[model samples]
Target: MSDVLAADSATIGEPAVNISIFGVFVLITLVITFRASRNNKSAADYYAAGRNISGQQNGLAIAGDYLSAASFLGIAGAIAVYGYDGFLYSIGFLVAWLVALLLVAELMRNTARFTMADVLAFRMRQRPVRMAAAISTLAVSLFYLLAQMAGAGGLVTLLLGVSGEAAQAVVVTVVGALMIFYVLVGGMRGTTYVQIIKASLLIVGAFVMTVWVLGKYGFNLSSLIGGAQDLAVEGRDVAAPGAQYGATGTSKLDFVSLGLALVLGTAGLPHVLMRFYTVPTAKDARRSVVWAIWLIGIFYLFSLIIGYGAGALVGPERILAAPGAVNAAAPLLAFELGGTVLLGIIAGVAFATILAVVAGLTITASASFAHDVYASVIKKGQVTGNGEVRVARITAVVIGAVSIGLGILALQAGINIAFLVALAFAVAASANLPTILYTLFWRNFTTQGALWSIYGGLIACVTLIIFSPVVSGAPVNPVTGVSPSLIQDVDFSWFPLNNPGLVSIPLSFFLGWLGSKLSKERPDELKSAELEVRAFTGIGAEKAVAH
Candidate 1:
C-alpha cells in the first residue's frame, strides 16, 4: 500500500488537505438546513413551498439542480482524459436548457398543480397516467440519486483517506439523513434556499478557478491549444503508448452519441423540470428558465476552461488511476499557482455543490412518492396539508436509504462517475422526456400513448444498455477474449454508441405517436384537452375559473 501511494504520488503528486475549509462548509450547510426547516409547514409548503418561490430564487435553485457531481467532477475528469471530445458534453448540456426554456417550462407551470404527473394526466383520468409518470420519475430520479451517492462516497473516501466501502457507507448514511431532514423539516423552502446558496458559490468558485488557470497559461488561445495537443500526444504514449485518443474512426461515433444524450437528456430530467414548477406564475417559470440558461451557460463555459486546465496541468495518467477519488483538481491547481487559502475556498465550494445537488434530488424524489404516488394516487386525492408533509418526510427517508444501498453496490462494480451519469441521462431522455413533451404539445396524445411511451422507451433503453459492449465487465468474446467486441464474428457488434438516447429518443416518439393513432378518443376528453391547452397557453385561466 505504501509503494502504491508512492507511485501515485510520483505520477499525480501529493494532494493537499485543509480541514478548516471543510469545517466551514459543514457549518454553512447546517445553518442553511436549519433556516429551511423553519419555513416548513403543510404538505404544500413542504413539496411546492406553497408555490411562492420567487423567479430569481427558483432560477438559482434550477442552476443548483443542473450542476451535479457529474458536472463538477466528471466533466473535469472527462476533459482531462478525452480532450476536446469531453468538452462536447458540457456544450451539449448547456444547449438542452434552451429546450427547457422555450418548450417545457411555462407549460409545466401552467398545467400541473404540482408534479409531472399533473401534466401527463391533465386531459385524462389520473390513475393510469399518474402511475406511469410516478414509475418513470422514480426510476430516473433513483438512477440519478445512485450516481450522486456513488460520487459522494468516492469523494469522501478520497478526501479523508478512509476505506472505499466504509466511505461509501458513511456518505450514504450522512447524505441520506441530511436529505430526510431537509425534506421533513424544511421541504421546498429549505431545499430551494440551499440550492440557491450552493449554486451561487459554485459559479463564483468555478469562475475564480478558471481565471486563475487562464492567467497561468497567459490567456493565449493558440498557446493553450498547442499545450493541449502536446500533452495529449505525450500522455497517450505514456498511458497507452502508440494509442490514439481523439476523434478517430469509431470514437467519433461515440462522441456524437454522447453529445446527443447530454443535449436531449437535460430536457427530460424530472428534478430539473420540477424546479420550474416551484415558481408562482407561468411567466415566472419562463423567466426562471431564462435565468437558469444564462447561469448554466456561464458555468459550462467555466467547465470547459477547467477541463482543459486539468488536461494540461494534471495529465491523464494521474487522473485515471483514481478518477473517482480526486475532488480537488481545481483546488490543487489553485494551490500550485496561487496558495493554500484558494485551495481551501475551492474545496468548500465543491462540498457545497455536492450537498446542494443531493438535497435537491432527494426533495424531488420525495415529492414524487408523497404527492404523485401516495396523495394523488393511492389516497385518491384526499390527502391534505400536514398529513401530506408527513408522508413526504417518510418518503425522503425511504429514498435516501435506497440511494445509499445503490451507492454501496456501485463501489463493488468499479463504476466511473461519468458513465453512471450518462446512463441516468439516457434513461431520463428516453423515458420521461417523450411522455411529458407529447402530453403538453400534442392534443391527440392518449393515456395509452403516454403509458406505452414511458414503459416501452424505458424497457428498450435499459435492455439495450444491458447488452451493449460498454458494460465495464461485459463478457469477453470466446475466441478473441476482448471485453468490448470489435470484430464482426462476435455475437453482437452493432451501434458502437454506448448511450441509447440517439436511438431510444426517436423510438420513444415513434411509440407515442403510434399508440395515439390506435387509441379511441372521446369528444368530451378532446374538449377537456383543448381547455387544458388553452390554460397552459394562458388563454383560458379566467374562463377556467369562471366554470
Candidate 2:
C-alpha cells in the first residue's frame, strides 16, 4: 500500500498552473449557470427549457450526458489492463447508441411533457402511473449519480495528491454546488450550453491523443498488435491475446449477457431520454440522433486506438497496480509525447467533462423529483411554471447533498469503480426501459400494469445485486480470498447475471403484460393509447389536459 501511494504521487506531482486553471474553469461554469436562470419562468422552462432547444445543440448535450466518467476513465483503464477484450466494452457502448436512435429518441420527443411520467400517464389515471414512473426515474438516476460521484472522488484524489477521503469530499461539495447553481439559474439553457462545450472539448482531446499515438507507431496496426502479442507471450499463462485480456475464451454466454445489457441499456437511460424533449420537432430529434451517432462513433474509434496505445507503450503492469489512479492515462500519454503544456490542456478537458455530466444529472434528478413527484403527483398539478422552477432549485440542493454523502462513503469503503457504473446501467435498463416500451407500444397497458412493472423490476434488481457474488466479496475461491462463497452459508446463489438487466428486464415486460391482463377491462384504455401513438408521431398535437 505504501508503494502504491508513492507511485501514484510520483505520477501526479503538483503543478501550480494546472490546479489554478481547473479552479478558474469551475468558477466560469458557476457564472454561466447563474446567468442561465434569468430566462427560466415556469416549470417547463426549468425542466425542459420551454422545449425550445435546437436539434444540434440538444444532440451535443446528449453526447455530454451519455459520456460519463465510466466512458472516459473506466473504459481506457479497462483496455490498458485487459487488452482487446476491454475494447469490446467500447464497441458495446457505441452500438447501444443505435438502439436509442431506432427505438427511443423521436418517440420520446413526441410523447411526454417534461418527464417520462408525463408520457406513461397520458393513457392512464395520473396518480399511480406518475408515482411509479417517478420512483423508477429517481432510482435509476440516483444509482447512476452515485457512480459518477465515486469516479469524481477517485479522479480528484489522484490528480491533487490528497488523501482519498478529502478528495471525495471536495469533489462532492464542488460539483454539488455547481450543479445546484446550474439548475437554479440557467435551468436547461445553462445546462445545454455547458454540455455542448464539454462534449466538443472531450472529442477534440481524444482525437489529439489518438493521432499522436498512431503517428508514433507509424500508423502500423499490425505492428502495434504484434507488440502487444509479444508481451502476452512472456506472461505467466502464455495465452492468446484475447484470452490474456479476460475475454472469457470460448464461453459465449458471458459475452451475450454483456452485450444484452450494454445494447438495451442505452435506450433506457432517463437522462438521455429527457434530452430529446429539448428539440423542437420529431424530425429535428431524428436529425440530432444521427449527429450524435456520428460524433460518438468517432470518439469510440479513438478510444480503441488510445487503449492499444496504452497497452503497447505504457504497458499493463503499470496500469493495474493503481487502477483508480490511472484515470490520467490519456493526459499522461500527452505529456510523454508532447510535454507539460499539452498535458495541462488534457487535464482541463477532463475536469470540464466531469462538471458537464454531473450538472446534467443534477438537473435531470431535480426535474424528476420536482416536476414529476412534487407538482404533478403531490400537488395534483396546481403548481405553475415559476413555482415549479423554485421547487426544482430546492430539490437540486437536496440531491446534490445526497450525492456528496454517497461520494464520501464510497471512498471510505474502497468500492470497485467499474462495477459500480455497470450496476447503474443494469438498474436503469431493468426498472425503467420495460415500462417505457410497453406504455408506448401496448394499448392494453393499464396504470396498474406500469406500477407493477416498476416495483417488480426494482425489487428484483436491487435484491439480486445485494446477494451477487461480486458485491458480497466472494469470487471463485482462487481469484478472491473466500474459500466458500459467502452466500453459501446463508442460502442462495444470487441471480445469474452480474447485471440484473439480463434477468429483470424480461421480468418487467412479463409483469406488465400479466398485470394488464388480470385487471378489469377498461375499454377506454385502448382508445387513449391510439391517441398517444398519433400525438407522438406528430399526426396530432395533444391538448393540455387538466391535472
Candidate 3:
C-alpha cells in the first residue's frame, strides 16, 4: 500500500499534452451541443429530438451511450487483472442487447412517447403506475451514474497527474458540471450528436490500440495470450477461467447472479429504452438496434485484445500500484506502447466516453421525473410542452449534483466500475423487467402488479445489496490491509453472495404474478386492446400520447 501511494504520484501523462488534448475535445463537444440546442423549441425536441434522428445516426448514438466507462476503463482493467472471468462482462453485455432487439425495442418505440412510464401507464391507472415507474427509472439511472462518475474521477486524475481523494472529488464535480451543461443546453439532440462523435472516437481509438498491441506479438493472438500468461503473477493464468471469480461455491453463485442481471437488465434500462423513442418509427428502432449490435460487437472484440495486451505489456503489479488502481490499466498500457502522445489521445477519448454516457443518463432520469412524475401526475396533464422542458432542466441539475457526491464516495470505496455497473443491472432487472414483460405480453396484467413488482423488487434487491459482502463483509486484501467492501472495517453482511440478481429477479417475477392474481381492480379493456394493437402493428403510433 505504501508503494502504491508512492507510485501514484508518478506522471501518467505529460501534463501539457494531456490537458491540451482533453481541452480540445471538451471544446469541440460543447460547440456541437450549443449548435444542436438551437432547435429545442418544444418538449418533443428536448426529450426525443423531435423523433427526427435517422436510424443509423441513432444507432451510433446508442453505441456511444451504451459503451460507457465500464466498457473501456473498468472491463479492460478487470481483464488485465482477472483474465477470462473479466471477459464475461463483455459477453453478458453484448448478448443482453438481443433481449432489447427482440422483445422491447420496436414495441416501445411504437407505444410510448417520452419515457418508459408512458408505456407502463398506457392501460393501467395512470398516476400510480407512472409514479412507480418513474421511481424505478431514477433508481437505475443513479446507480449507473455512480459508475460513470467514478470512472471520470479516476481517468481525469491520472491524465492530469494528480493524486489524492480531494483531487478526484474535484475531477468528479467538473465532470458532473459538464454533463449538466450537455443535457440542459443540448437536450436529446445535442446529447445524441455528442454520443455519435464519441462513439466514433472510442471505436477508432480501441481499434488502433488493438492493432498496435497485436503487431507486437507478430499479429498472433496465441503468442499474445502466451506472453500475457508468462507475465502473470506466479500461479496465475490469464488464459484460464478462475483468476477472479472461481475460487469458491459462493463466488460461482455470484457469477451466476451477475450473468442473470446483465442478460435481462439491458431491456429494462430506462436510458437505453428511452433511446428507442429518438428514432422516427418502429422500423427505424429495429434498424438502430441492428446497427448498434454490429458496432458494439466489433468493439468488444477489440476489447478482448486490448485487455490481454495490457496484462502482457503493462503487467498486473504496475496496474495494481497505479493511482486509480485497476482502472489505470489501459492508460498505463498506452503510455508503455507510445509514450506521452498516445497516452494523451487515449485519455482524451476516455474522458469523452465518460461525458457522453453520463449526459445520456442525466437526461433519462430527469425526463422520467419531469415528464412522468411532474407533468403527468403532479400537473395532471395540464402543463405545456415548454413548461415540462423547464422542469426537466431543473431536474437535470439536481441529479447531477447528487451523482457527484455519490461518485466521490464510490471512488473512496475502490470498487471496480464494471462490478458497480453489474449491480445497477441487477436493480434494473429486479425492479423493471418483469413488470415490463407482463405489461406487454399479458392482457390480465393490472396496475397492482406493476406496483408490486417495481416497489417490491426494488426494495428487496436494495436490501440484499446493503447486507451483501459487497457492502460490508468482504475479506481484506492482504497487500492493502483493507476490506474491499464499500463500508469497510465492519462485517455486517448477511447475504453470502456478492450479487442479489439470482434471488431478487425470481422474487420480482413471482410478485408480479401474485399481485395481478390478487388484485380485483380490473384493467380497462379498450386501452389494453389499443396497446396490444399499437405495440404489434404500429397502428396509430404517431399520436401515441394523445390520450
Candidate 4:
C-alpha cells in the first residue's frame, strides 16, 4: 500500500493539521479513561459498567461499536464506486440488529452476567460449556481485533502521513496501550463513554458531509446520482447493483451466504452480547436496542448520501488512483467539501471509531478469559473480587499486545481483510447463534447439544473459510485489477462457495438437535424452569455488582 501510494504520488498534502486533530481526539479519550478508572472497583463495574448506563447512552455506544471502519468508510466507498450495491451491506447490517432486539436482547440481559458463557452454563454442565463459549468468544473477538488493528495501522499511514514500518508499529502499539487503559483501568464504563463520544462525532461528521455533498449538487438526488454515474470510470452502471455478484450462480450463493452472516451474526457477537449485562433491567436492554435501531438506521440512511457526495465531488477515478484509498472516499470527500479542518475532523472521528471498537472487543475478550476460563475452569470458581479483576486486567494487556503484534504483521503482509470481517460474522452466526437460541428456547437442549453446537459451529466456520475461494481466488476488482484472493499464486480452493454461512448455519442447528437426541443424559427440567422465569420476567436474575 505504501508502494501504491508512492506509485500514485499520494501525500496527505498537509500532515500537520491532520496530526493535531488526531492528537486532540486521543487526549480527550485519555481523560475519559482516567475518570472511568477511578469509579471502577468491582467485577461488575469493570465488565458491565455497573449496570448504571442508561438506555440512550448504551444505544449510542452500541452504534459506536457497530459502525466500524466497514460502515463508515468501506460501505460508503462501495456506494461511491459501485452505487446501490454498497447500500445493501448497510441494510444487511441494520437488519441483523432486529434479530437481536426481538429474540436475544432482553432474554440475554435476564439470563447472563459478564459473558455469553454464563447463559450457556446456566442450565448445562459448568466447565465444558464455559470452555466452549469462551473459546468461541475468543475466536470471534480476536479475529475482529486483528482486522480492526490492521485496518487501523494502514489507515494511520493514510491519514497522518506516518511513514515506515517503525512508525506503523508505534501507531498500533500506542493504540494498543490506550486500549489496555480503556479495558483494564476504565473497563466497560470507559469503553461505553468513548463509544458514545465517537458515535456522536461520527453522526455530526456525516451530517456535515451530507450537507456539503447535497449542497454541491443543489440537493437534487437525481443530479447527484447522475454525477456519480459519470464518475464511474469502469463503465459499470453506478445506479444499480452491479454484475459481480450476479455474474455466476456461485457468486449469487456467496452473496446469500454473506447476507445470512451479516443478518444473523450481531446477536452472537461477544461484545454486543456483553452490552446487555451493563444495564439494570431487561427492559433497559430492550429499550437500548430500540435506541440503537433509530441511531444506526439514521446513520446508514445518511451514509448513502455521503457516498453519492463522494462520487459527485471526488470521482471514482481519483479514489481508485490511490491504493487503499478506497476506504478514504468519505474522508477525501470531506477534504474536498470543507478543506483541511473538515478532513481533520473525519480523521479524528475515524481514529475514535477504531478506538471505541477495539476497547469494546478488548473488554469482551478479557472478560471471557477472566470469568469463563481463569476463574471458572482453572480456579474452579475460586476467584472473586479483585482476584478476578486482576486476571481481567492481565488478559486485557495480553490481548492488546497480541493485537498490536498482529497489526504490525498485517501492515507488512498487505493482506486484504475485507473477507475477515465477513468471516467474523459467519463464525458468530454459525457457531454461536444456534447454541444461544437452542439454550434459550429448547426444552430438550442438553449439555451435549450446547457443546456440540458451539464447537461444531466454530470448527466448521473456520475450516470452510480456509477452503473457500475467497481465501484463494474468486473475483478481481474491475477498476483496481486486484483479485480478492488472499494468496496471489494459489488457486486450490475446493469449496465451491465464498461464504460458509449457508452450509454452516444449518449444520449447526442440525448438530444441536442430533447431539441432544443421542446424549444419554436427560434434560434438567428444573434448571430450565428456573432459567425460564428469569429470562422472561427478570425475576431472580443476576444483579450488577455495585461499585
Best by lDDT: 3
Per-residue lDDT for 198 in model 2? 82
What TM-score, over all chains together, does every model reach?
Answer: 0.87, 0.89, 0.97, 0.94
Off by over 4 Å in 4: 1-11, 163-170, 408-419, 474-478, 542-547
Give the clashing pairs for model 1: none
lDDT of each: 0.69, 0.68, 0.89, 0.81
CA lDDT for candidate 2: 0.68
Candidate 4 to truth, TM? 0.94
lDDT per residue for candidate 3 within 1-547, as digits (tens), equals 2322222324485777888989999999999999999999988888888889999999999999988889998899888887888899999999999999999999999985899998999899999999999999999999999999888888887887776777778878988898888888999999999999999999999999999999999999999989888778678888899887878888899999999999999999999999999988899999999999999999999988988999999888888766677788889888889888888899899889788888889999999999999999999999998899999989999999999998888877778899889999999999999999999999999899999999999999999999998889899875445677888778988999888999999999999999999999887889989999999999989776444
Instruction: Tell me, by TM-score, which candidate is best.
Output: 3
Error of 1 at 273 (Å): 1.3
Candidate 3 lDDT trough over 10 residues, lowest sum: 1-10
Cα miss at 404, model 1 (Å)? 1.7
Q: Write the per-residue lDDT of candidate 4 for residues 2-84, one digit (tens) a residue.
A: 54323111435466777788889989998998898788878888888888998888899999998887778777877887788
From the highest TM-score down, the ranking of the candidates is: 3, 4, 2, 1
Please, what are the lDDT tens digits per residue for candidate 1 over residues 368-427?
777778888899878776777677777778888888888766643445466677778888
